[model samples]
Target: MTEWWLWMYVAAMAGGVVLFTRWRADPCGVPLSEYRVAIAIPLWSGFWYLVMALGGGRAEVAGHTLYWARYADWVVTSPLLLVALTLTATHSLPGRRWGLMSTLVGANVVVILGGLAAELTADATARYTLYAIGVLALLAVYGLIWGPLRAHAHRQPKEIAAVYREAALLLSVLWVGYPLFWLIGPAGAGLISSATTSLLFVLLSILTKVGWSIVDLGRLRSLSGRGRLTVV
Candidate 1:
């Protein structure tokens, strides 16, 4: 990984943390969509920590970066997959959130294990290729399945719609960027393009989540006003 980009990625990661803090502090003003999508923070947080701890400080990695990078797939995927699945299980979801969630989780697991095997077996191409495909598939399914629930949530108000839309677009950004950085950016682009991509992901995570929190807050306020929130 190029040294310059590595610092850039670090800066971006820092920005994300800042945004998450803002969102958490002002949840009432943020959108509900945030509560779910914000899961990305934890994923990235774990990843960044892994890279630093195992890959020799922020600026350098003494050995094969792949060794540390490989752990990222499992570390980021496992917990996030669980969160996505849990959110989908809600009765409030219009369709089978679990089914779609399962698909996404299953795909990640497959890619993680496949990548591990490929790496262990000395098949770099196979490992990265599987990871790329799995991520793309996961993104597509996430958009399709979660899109509707978000839409319904948006239908309640213009502000709500704005929140959901922002969240969707943010998700899209991640879907697009993560793969590009991995597939096209130089090896350990995690280090090379660290600042740019990390910043992008973090900012998107925060802004979209802000929108999400706002929508949810608005909805709750409205329900309370109508005495509907307590009906159930």
Candidate 2:
């Protein structure tokens, strides 16, 4: 299963590409039209991760392995992920442009990168500490999701509120596992196999990315007064 991670990368890129392509084909020109880059970044970065992995891009230092491509992928995709979420959440808001997304999403990036470094560190204490920090960051993220974000959603219509709530819940659930995943990776104490870790990564990305996009798609339907689509 040495290439299991690579396969996951390939599959995610392929699927995301197809999904985004269909989204482009659709003719929703008002606001769903504006999020092309938000939805597109992850798909693009997913391909880069696959390419870098297949091209044998990896580094090992002090008993720790790093996938440079994955890091690069995160550099672009993480920001876009937050943007996508922020934009989706703000969709129902009256005149809020960025909403709490800038603050919370910036913090999320720091937490995630810090957690990655913690996993690569050899000191158990530091790793645990960093994991704790990541957890706290997520807690704050949840607070914003349920607190300010929810409040904004509540100010909107019922269907809009439903979209924001579902998106937030899905994001929270999917992200809650990331720190754990970091722990179980080549750096973590959980010591899962590479194949298992790769599979988990696939599951996380697919569920979170597609799940968020689908919720937003439903919101699109609500705004456009259309029906639900099996795929967005």
Candidate 3:
């Protein structure tokens, strides 16, 4: 069952790669950077899923089978997703854009790394301590997204502002599921089987990476067609 879900994840990501590549043909004045990030997210994730499906990306950590490759994938792709979303809001504010993006990405790195460490730690106190750190970092991510990022997005043309809001909201909601699943799954407690955890992660990844990218790029295309969006 776990193997089946991993294959499903690989297929989903492959579809994302193909879809984004075809969309790249005519960006309709939308920046190619956005397409590049969108495509990269799925491309990298597909490769990692392929590795896991082949039984090459797991290890016994703290008596639990840990798919560290998932963390490896998230460490890179999550930041890229944030960069894609951040670009939409900060494209018009070049002076402080990179600074804000760097801070957000840095916080995201901590979130992933903390989770990884927690999974590897056997001590209950240490594991929960790491988990708490990750949760805190996630809150920091939300703060940046809702506070400063939303402020910048609102200052954009209404169409672009709307696009940013939708993307941000989708990501914010989907991301909360990761820690919840982690807390209840084999990693944190023995409440759920590994296969079930794999299935849930597969669904979440598809939505967060492929589904979100489709909505983001599609909306950008619509904005471009109406002359409300331009290459930054």
Candidate 4:
């Protein structure tokens, strides 16, 4: 069942790559950078999933089996996802925007690393400490997304602002599932079986990566069709 979920993730990510490729072909005024980032997210994620499906990227840590590759995948792709979303909110890169983006990405890195460390730690207190750090970093990520980022999106034309809102909201909501699952799954309290956790993670990954990208790029395409999107 766990293997099935891993392969399913691989398939979902492959589908994401194909879908994003088709979207990229449209010469809409949407910035090419967005397309590039969107494509890279799933492409990298698919690679890691494929690796895991092939029985790679797993480890026995603290008497629990851990797929560290998932953390490896998240460490890279989450930053890229934030980059894509931040670009959507701030159409043109300004000095201040760069700072915000940097902090957002940095916070995300800490979150991933903290989770990985927590998973590897055998000591309960240390494990929870690492998890706390991760949760704090996640809160920082949320604050930036909903605060300055959302404010910047509101400054754009209504169509563009609408796209950012939908994309940001989708991301914010879907991301909460990760920590929740981690808390209940093998990584924390072990309230659920590993197979169930694997299935849940697979579903969440598909939604947050492929699902969010579709909504984002699709809305941008719609704006382009109506001549509402302009390349800056």
- Model 3, span 1-232: residue lDDT tens: 3478899889999999999988899877777888999999999999998999998899999988999899989999999999999988865554438888999999999999999999999999999999999999999999999999999988878888999999999999999999999999998877999888988999999999999999988998998788777565
Which stretches of model 2 miss by more than 4 angstroms? Answer: 1-5, 226-232
Q: Whole-model lDDT for model 2 versus the true structure?
A: 0.66
Per-residue accuracy of model 2 over 1-232 as CA lDDT, tens digit each: 2566666766766676676667667635326533575457657666765665565556774376666566566656666666666656666455555647687777777777776677567788987887788778778777877887777667666666676677777777787776778777766765886557656866776666655676666466556655332112
Q: How accurate is candidate 1 locally (lDDT)?
A: 0.45
| 1 versus 3: better TM-score goes to | 3
**lDDT leader:** 3
Query: lDDT tens digits, residues 1-232, model 1?
Result: 4334344444554555455556556544333443445536444643554465444433223223343443453346443633433342232334435565566566556545544443343345665666666566556556653665464544444543443454445444444554554444333223555445444534443333333334333454454455433211
Give Cα-based local distance difference scores for all models. Answer: 0.45, 0.66, 0.90, 0.89
* Candidate 1 off by > 4 Å: 1-26, 29-64, 67-70, 73-99, 111-121, 124-136, 139-158, 185-232
Estimate candidate 2's RMSD in Å.
Answer: 3.7
TM-score of each: 0.50, 0.83, 0.96, 0.96
